[model samples]
Target: MIIMWKNDITKEIEKKRLKIRKDEDLFETVEEVFDTRTLMALYRIINKGIISEMRGVVKSGKESRVYWAKDKNDNDIAVKIYLTSSMEFRKSIFQYIQGDPRFKVVKDYRKMIYTWAQKEYKNLQIAYEVNVSVPKPIYVYENILVMEFIGENGVPAPLLKDLSVINIELFNQIIDAIKKLYNKAKIIHADLSEYNIMVRNNKIYIIDFGQAVTIEHPMSYEFLLRDIKNIVRFFRKNGIDVPDDEVIIKWIKEV
Candidate 1:
């Protein structure tokens, strides 16, 4: 019975695989990312009607790639797929997972990558629930995460680091986001920085929460301080008058 069940599941996955292959352009783009397992995971997501069509790559890095996609309703969404074969990514994220109480350290590389994707999804959900300015998480399956797109058409919002003109208001808004993320959501964005922050229409949206840890983590305070320092350093470099990192950390911890 178990063997029969396994075969049935395989047949279903193969059916989805064929459906995905019908879109040659999307199949070609997906081929650039990884192997059959990743494709199968994406197929499962498509089978659920969460994604209608996969579009062009918006961002690519050693760890993951973000692709613009459309949902069944024809609305844009972001699909983030973590690279299962990136040893560098595995090494870099190990520290974040080590001290995080919510996730246990896994020995299998592929499973670790999946956990990393789930971590980001959960973190985004927690932040979004608290009204923190973050992308709304839609679904997570294996190494793939689907979320609300933060831009129009196929163009993404400019990162804070890429912007030429940043004002004090932006800095203050970011600080407020950090405080809310800390005090309300109880999640510390361990990898917070200008590069992961998106600015659109004078509003700031924090991105990339895979490395964020809850306040109960052993190194949460250390990570929190580092996040404060990164924001302060960036705003100060842009000629915005900002309080010292220490002072800002104190203020965030209050309440």
Candidate 2:
């Protein structure tokens, strides 16, 4: 896990933008590409032995920014650093995070994100332990998470929604895998849509577990059903045969 760094990319980035204020949360205060604290965290990771350099920014979502980084062994890594400077961003994830047992005591937004980041790291570890196809987690600190890069070279794998290959067999495998994730792992990939599952080298790698909650948690059944709905819907759109309820039933009863 990357902890800290000596370089200051934030200052360099600041130099590029002359009109912006130099506040600590400058990244969040403005409509800039990234938050100041988050960029510093990336620099810290690089200055330390955790990562060599920041390759480039990949996706900047509402809560976090994902970047490609190189590790000491010259292997590519994906770093998801959350922005704690924005309460608005924090508000977005609260609904999915509020009921989790781990974050029952979290009160502040930053603290909530810290807990969420930790939860994702733990979820990834659990999936790996259960032999679930997922990115191997490397390190997590503050609201930052580092993991093995999912795509080959410097490019990221496209979401399953954009690509289709083979037949219902592989699609069935995805269904079976989701069932195993529920039955064996006792967790739901809450955001289990075509956008979250990646198909690479004809194998499926499930990404983004930040919203995954236990089956016993409140609204778990709803989330699981939605996942089944999305899985079935996407595959069906690709010309596969099977009803959503049939896939749901198979997942619940026999997978």
Candidate 3:
């Protein structure tokens, strides 16, 4: 009876090991892309029960890559990882963090990247709290930020720039979203454009808040005007009779 019990236990252990191996195999390609430090950071996050599995890349950009992942409860999560080796990114993000009262100046590049990730998370949180249409922020660890994925399965919603159908109401909704971000969230999406606006389920969502600045920033109004201009330009090109950026800006500034 003891010998039979030992054989059954060994078989169960082997089955569990096989299951782990199969799960790890799914991310083999993803594992090859991360560096040692990033891998360790991801390991720490996973061990903390934040992430159950990382699937594949959902969006790829010059400075970062967003991956489709799942939490312990199998809920969809977007994991955005800032590339530490991108020297251009390191230099470009300096302007966004320079005058922000929230963070101190950091000389280390890796620390700066971490700070950038944290900044985006905080920006999303602020926007979300104010009913702005943005991905709900979950957590930020090192250079990785986890947020609510804004699409179904592993597929992300199409950018406003990619949508074939454009309507006047949608344009108006985008304008209202920007105004709300400014008045309620008190932040300017300095880099706002059609490229970062996601269209899913007939709703517009603003994204890529890494460069958003507080209203106190010296360039806040300038950034706000630029955001308005970008949205107006896009809508005009799509044949929407949009008002001028100045008019929109003046209306948004009304208290």
Candidate 4:
């Protein structure tokens, strides 16, 4: 009976994959790297009606690629797929996983990558709940995470690093966002910097929460200080006089 149930489930997943293939073309640029399991995950997401048409790649990174997609309702969404085959990615992600209490230490590399994707989703949810400006998470299964698209008409918003003008008001807004993310959400964006912030209509939206850790993480304070320092350095270079990193960190941690 158990073997029969397993076969039934396998047939359902294959049916979904066939339906997805008939509906749209996906993973054009990423075709070489996407294994059968990854393709199945995408099919599952489509079967759930989270995404309808999977479009072109918006951004590609060493460990993941962000795809522009449309949901069943025709709303734009960003689909992030973590590459399961990168050995370096596996090694690099260990530090963030080591001290976190939420996840148990999984030995399998693929499972670890899935956990990393889930971590980002959970972190985004925490920030969203506290009114922090982040991409609204829609769904996550295995290595694929679907979220609100940060741009319009298939173009992404400009990264803070790419912007030529850096206004003082905008600088303060980012600082306030950092404070809220810390004090309210209790998550430190360990990898925060100009590169991870998107500027849309003069508003700041934080992205890339895969490395963020809760306040209880062992390296949380250090990570927080590093985040503050990175932002402060960028603003100072742009001629926006900001408070010292230590002062900013103190303010963030203060009730």
Q: For candidate 4, list the clashing residue pairs, or say none.
A: none
lDDT of each: 0.91, 0.76, 0.88, 0.90
Which residues of candidate 2, in runs, are more than 4 Å off? 1-33, 85-88, 164-166, 253-255
Candidate rank order under lDDT:
1, 4, 3, 2
Q: In model 4, state the lDDT of residue 131.
A: 93
Q: Estimate each model's TM-score.
A: 0.91, 0.80, 0.92, 0.90
* Model 4 lDDT tens row, 202-232: 9999999998998899999889888988999
Error of 3 at 234 (Å): 0.5
State model 3's lDDT: 0.88
* All-Cα superposition RMSD per candidate: 6.1, 7.5, 2.5, 6.2
- Counted clashes in each candidate structure: 0, 4, 0, 0
Residue 91 C-alpha lDDT in model 1:
82
> Which candidate gets the maximum lDDT versus the true structure?
1
Ranked by lDDT, the better of candidates 3 and 4 is: 4
Worst 10 residues of 2 by lDDT: 22-31
Q: List the residue pairs that clash in candidate 3.
A: none
Query: Model 1, which residues run further than 4 Å from truth?
Result: 1-21
